[model samples]
Target: MTASNDIDALAAMLLVRELESALSAREDCGFQLLSSGQEAVAVGVAAALLAQDQLLCSGRSIAPALARGLDPGRVMAELIGRASGPCLGRGGRGHLSQPSAGFFGAHAVVAGNLSIAAGVALALQARLDRSIAVCLFGDGACGAGALHETMNIAALWQLPLLLVCDNNLYSVSTPRAAALAPQRLSDLAAPFGIKACTVDGMDVRSVRGAAVALTDHVRSGGGPAFLECVSRRFASHSTSARETRGQQELAADRELDPITRLEKALLLEGALSTQTALGLREQVRARVTAACAFAEASPLPVPDEAFADVG
Candidate 1:
């Protein structure tokens, strides 16, 4: 997770540009979404994950999914309900995943993937291996009873699971303060004797550092660890939701634009030159373009797939 100066800057720049392009495509589909605002939460946490580690993400994290190696064209296609998509156009943007990239999936249901992450961990345990499951959810999901049950099981079994709560302070317009009694999402882990920490979700490096530490802790046979990343949503909750509320404006957003913040840090730290950053950004854009072309040219699922994949 500790990248050298050049690598870190390269990763930050590439991911930021990819996110920008993906969100643009999503918007072109007539869906004014809220992913650009939460870029840092994904960039930071995803930077810490190894390519082999699995991501059990929530619906709010399209940006993060792209960082974790999902194809932008396919994702955008999925968002627009196109045939060329990761889930074969079956799962839309909110349900997108690329398992080969270790992105398991994201569910629309609140806290739905918590137990599934635990199950993935259990499967790893059955193999007697040490791979980890990283679950990213919202602070609102912490209020769900499933989170509580999953916490107890994760702690009791000492599963290698890193539970990340993206505490963006809103559950589709109902603010975090209004829904949850606990001010901090990490606090929910204490009852299960799980180690927990809170990171500035808006800072990719900070989030990466915290995730690496937590990953190490879990790999060392420790129980579950909780990390609460306080982030912000720039647009409305969804394409339809934003159109309803007219976009909730918040002063908090101006403080932390994840892409800009990371770029500034790279420049301040002298990690990369403006030209080098620009080149990397172009490379990301090119890659995404190619991916989209590949996906568009790919064949669709046979009509028999429904019967084929059914258990």
Candidate 2:
């Protein structure tokens, strides 16, 4: 990565981190699946996408939505149930979408978006635009049959799709090892002969590098590719969910915070100075504050709006 791009990556991660931080502090934040420890997976994957490519993700979507370049204000409004939101306040946080911006949207269901992404890939394939459909799901979705069908069809038909697993080591209170049958989640793709790789989700640069290469192959008609990012989740499953982890486990996970990891890497590489790092945090905080203001300024949707977009 160039020095500029490195810093940009760092900033993007911070943007996600700060935005979630701000939202978590809100009394009306709703049931949020904050990406407190896995910002790298979202930012890294998004860095490789072109304007024409489409991205779909699971409910843990704040990082991906912001990383995909959705306006912070619009995202904030959507999360806060305001009229000016991307979905006009209908989809809420669980289903924030802006297709024109290449973010196909977020689905709260596990493995729910996999087939949808494949369907989208099929459409894009028919268009012959060289554009691909990417799905960012969690390891929890790996156990579902939707993944199996998606992979089989993607490989058999050579669909332009990129399957990304943001594995944060746990599915709610259940550890992945206890639940998932695969020794390595990426191995699931191997049966279908799809190109797959596992990378450190704590490292944004690693994710970006893998995504770029895999996306290039997918766009070039090399069929589908799977990427597994082994990451950490600092918070509970959701804001309303209980933290089932022991204090020690939470502390250890905090040590692997992707934002701090990348910031330290940039500083050590002379790509970022301490002053600039502080400035970036302040800037990100201000932007998030402005997002909150935008959301607050917009009125909540009225009862009549429930039928506004309904056909």
Candidate 3:
């Protein structure tokens, strides 16, 4: 039940580097740029999960997908619409999943994964398993009907689900304060009668602490809990969207970048050294490069293969 501090640090660094590589690739391909900011929320929340836990991500959850064990090259390939990528390049960057790593999948429709996560949790409950479901979505998703319904159902049934609201402040260009009436997203779950708590989304350790407690509750059959991770997205909406003007306006929010924060924590605690940090960065870069090469060298999905898995 202890937090995997080592894995958390590794995941944060790896996600950031891979994101940088993806952005560089997009830039070369004449795209505007993939998002640059938002590393803390995804990596922080993901670091809280057990290897056996399930994740339901949103379009912006590339970091979590990578940390959960998806190959960076395959992720990049998906972004570029290559046939060798996950979903055979059909799902694209946002709609991602790595079942082998317990990542259920992501949804394009806002709040679409909430209900799916509930279903997964319900199934796990029926099986009498201790595994919990982790549902991630943006602050914008909190306004959706799925959020309301899923919260009610999960709490009413006492399903073991952790609803992580990556409250990045903006749902596309509209800030949460302007679009949502209740700025505090955690309040929504209160009506559903579930335990809800908010955390400093920018700090992985804080997120890890909250996740540990919440997962423990779920393991003991304590229904569900909602965690609103209030973080910021450093990148634009995607690699092609240049209209994203929030990052500039949100510069004040970057006072605590998760990657830097974690590195400092590791260094101060003497858990790792500067040389080790550099080596880790290099290792991540090499792994990302290798993944890209793997995707490029792998054969593209065949033209007739589209219907092979659709029942």
Candidate 4:
């Protein structure tokens, strides 16, 4: 990787870590930290997308928003329920939306954004816009009818869409083996005639390469594509749940942690020095500290404003 790419990867990893740290320390509100294990998927996919392209993120994933350049302070503010947040403190971390950054929003319901993404793709096609729509979801969402219906329609209409599935093996404590029928989740796209592939989500470069190729195809008027990234969830599904995986499994997953892998790769390639890496991490932590301060000092939204944006 080039120096710039190495820097981007480092920044992405730092952002994920800092966000998790901030979320973990918050005591005022209960917020979920779902981006810990899935940072590479977000950074890789976001790197391959154009600035004008739209992103529809799943509920558990907000790393993409940060990768796309959303303000860290605002993101932290949102998670902490401050009025200055991206969602005016109403949606919190589960429903972050920054239109200027081309992130449509993050949805809480499984596969809910799939249909929304299809509609966005259709609209983009109608306007003859070259911009594409990318939807990020998890393996659990694959079981929902909404994904199937959206995939069928996107394929039939040749919509410019990319379906990115972060298959982290377990869906809220249930092993994927127990929930999914097919050995490969990407196989679900075969019946719909959409080209699909699987990649190592723990390797940022692997995910980025697949994302670039698949998105290029979709941008060139090919039907939507599906990419299943086989990853592992290193943290609990939510703050309230204990780690369900055994110690052995947790250790095995940590062995392939994306942040660690990327750091090793950069060090070996001479793209990043240990001191430089430490500095980058410290910089990110400082930013996160400031973001927390901002969130703490920001005022709460007035009760009268609750129904203002309802319509």
Candidate 5:
């Protein structure tokens, strides 16, 4: 990875760590955890995107917004249901929208954002500009009809859209082998004539390389692309999930932790020192603590205001 890519990877890792810490410590709502082990997807993809590009995140992940540099304080506020959040505390963690930052928001329904991303790409195509839309979903969503329909239209219209699947090997508790038929999720795009590939989601550099190449291809009018990132989730599917997996499984998953992998790579490459790495982790922890404090101090949304944003 380039120097800038290395730095971006570090930022993404730190943001993921901080978000996880904040969510675990949050006592309010039972919001889903951020994409724990899948930080590289958001970081790498967002790094390749232009300011005009729109990013749509999955329901179970908030790492995309943080990767786009959205303020953690606002993110925490949303999780805590504070009025100061990006959605004015209405959407919570599952539906964070910061259009100014090109974060289109996350969708809670499986494969729900795929069609919306295609529509956004259609609008971008109509504008005759180079802007693109990126939809981030999970492996579980690959089987959804909406994804198939969206890919069909996206390819037919040749919309500049990038579909990123965070294939963490599990759809909730069911393994990918049980949920998806095709060995590779990217293969689904072949029927639509869209360029598709799978990447090592645990490696930030690998993800960045693929994302940059694919985004450039789409931007240059090569049609849409699909990237399947093979990674793992370190936490339960959600707060309500009854199965946490066995301790051995959790430990095995952590062996591929993106943060640790990147840290070791950077250290070996002389890009970061051990002391600096520790300091960065500490800094992120402090930032998360402050953001949580800010969220706690903020007022709840007014009862009458709930009817304001409603259309």
Candidate 6:
């Protein structure tokens, strides 16, 4: 469940994890919704995506953007509000978009990108490109009206959109089970007759398999689909949010870290040797370092620059 028995998947997951870790250590790194524990969900879904497909995500954009093949250096720049970023750093964290790169961008609003994804899907359907739009949202957005309305239209029109809920169990400080009524979040899609399934978000292979199947269904004109990835959040909701979990609970959750899970399993199978694993880590660390250097050297936007992209 951790991988498709593929080292590439493992590598991608590590890259994001490390890149974020580097950012976390920086004093200037603004408040972030670090995808510390949800790397598997982003990497797994990205693995199944085609270059032409568009990916829209929530504010936790670092992992998704990196997973979708954006330049890590530029992503780092964007995260830190540098002029060298893909959106000229104006988009910042929650608004990093490089549509030409197939990353439609991330929305800071919980359910904000849901309808936007539907619109993108409709446009894709009109263009007859057969490419799809994948929207990665969190469990907190599950209660939004936009999701339901978008689902209804996506199902009715058979738009090539995939709704993936990166359900990390807790929405900020509140437990998902406490806020939502459905036994399974995927059940919300069932009423629309959309194909749906729930998988282990912490397992890269599981998420990849489910994403591939659902993306295929959308590609073949099977309309929209929904995938719920049940995962755990390692950190408090955000860098700015206070930790609400107890010490024992935090220790237990760390045991489920997706990266460690795959790394341990692969080591046991001899698919990955200690030397190779260490090498991969070093390689990714160098990449993150290089990215950091690039970001640090890049200049910030001039004050007037803010008026440039304005309507």
Residue pairs in steric clash, candidate 5?
A: none
Q: Rate the local accuracy (lDDT) of all candidates.
A: 0.74, 0.93, 0.74, 0.87, 0.86, 0.92
Candidate 3: C-alpha lDDT: 0.74
Residue 160, model 3: lDDT of 89
Best-performing candidate as measured by TM-score: 2
**In candidate 6, what residue range of length 10 has the lowest lDDT sum?**
1-10
Model 3: colliding residue pairs:
33-239, 34-239, 35-235, 35-236, 36-234, 36-235, 37-234, 37-235, 38-233, 38-234
Question: Which is the winner by TM-score between candidate 2 and candidate 4?
Answer: 2
Error in Å for residue 31 of model 1: 5.8
Number of clashes found in candidate 5: 0
Q: Write the per-residue lDDT of candidate 2 for residues 117-147, one digit (tens) a residue.
A: 9999999999898999999999999999999
Q: Tens digits of per-residue lDDT for model 5 on 100-167?
A: 89899898888999999998899888877799999999998999999999999999989999999989
Least lDDT summed over 10 consecutive residues: which range in candidate 5?
Answer: 25-34
Looking at model 4, the pairs that clash are none
lDDT of 6: 0.92
Worst 10 residues of 1 by lDDT: 242-251
**Candidate 4 structure, TM-score to reference:** 0.97
Expressed as tens digits, the lDDT of each residue in 76-178 for candidate 1 is 6676556788887667766888889888878767799898988887776565566788898887788899999999999999988889998888888787888
Tens digits of per-residue lDDT, candidate 3, 87-123, equal 7877766677777678887877788889999999998
Candidate 3's C-alpha runs over 4 A off are 1-11, 27-36, 244-250
Best model number under lDDT = 2
Scored by lDDT, model 5 comes in at: 0.86
Cα TM-score of candidate 1: 0.87
Residue 163 error, candidate 2, Å: 0.2
Query: Which residue segments of model 2 deviate by more than 4 Å?
Result: none
lDDT of 4 by residue, 132-183 (tens): 9999999999899998999999999999999999999888889999998998
